[model samples]
Target: MKEENLIVRSVTKKKYSSYAGEITPATPNLIQRNFKAEAPDKK
Candidate 1:
């Protein structure tokens, strides 16, 4: 292969992203980063 001067092609993998886009949420943020609750298994 070296003497023949042959080359091989390669494909690169696409990068993954978590960004969806600018859009309104389906439901309102009821938690609002509030994880504490009055009782256990409440929140």
Candidate 2:
């Protein structure tokens, strides 16, 4: 990408504050960092 003068656009991150101090259920990691794909360009 550098050779083609390509650049990556980044998203601006905003914080969510709903129920910030309340007790809530924990979120699960379904994939668990296993990002392998059977074919190229597939998630």
In terms of lDDT, the best-performing candidate is 1
Instruction: Residues 1-43, candidate 2: write the lDDT tens digits.
Output: 9899999999999887676686889899876898998998876
Weakest ten-residue segment in model 1 by summed lDDT: 21-30
Ten residues in a row with the worst lDDT in model 2? 15-24
Every model's TM-score:
0.34, 0.30
Mind giving the per-residue lDDT tens digits that candidate 1 earns over 1-43?
Answer: 8999999989999899989999886998889999989999997
Model 1 sits at a Cα RMSD from the real structure of 5.4
Clashing pairs in 1: none
Off by over 4 Å in 1: 1-25
lDDT of 2 at 8: 98
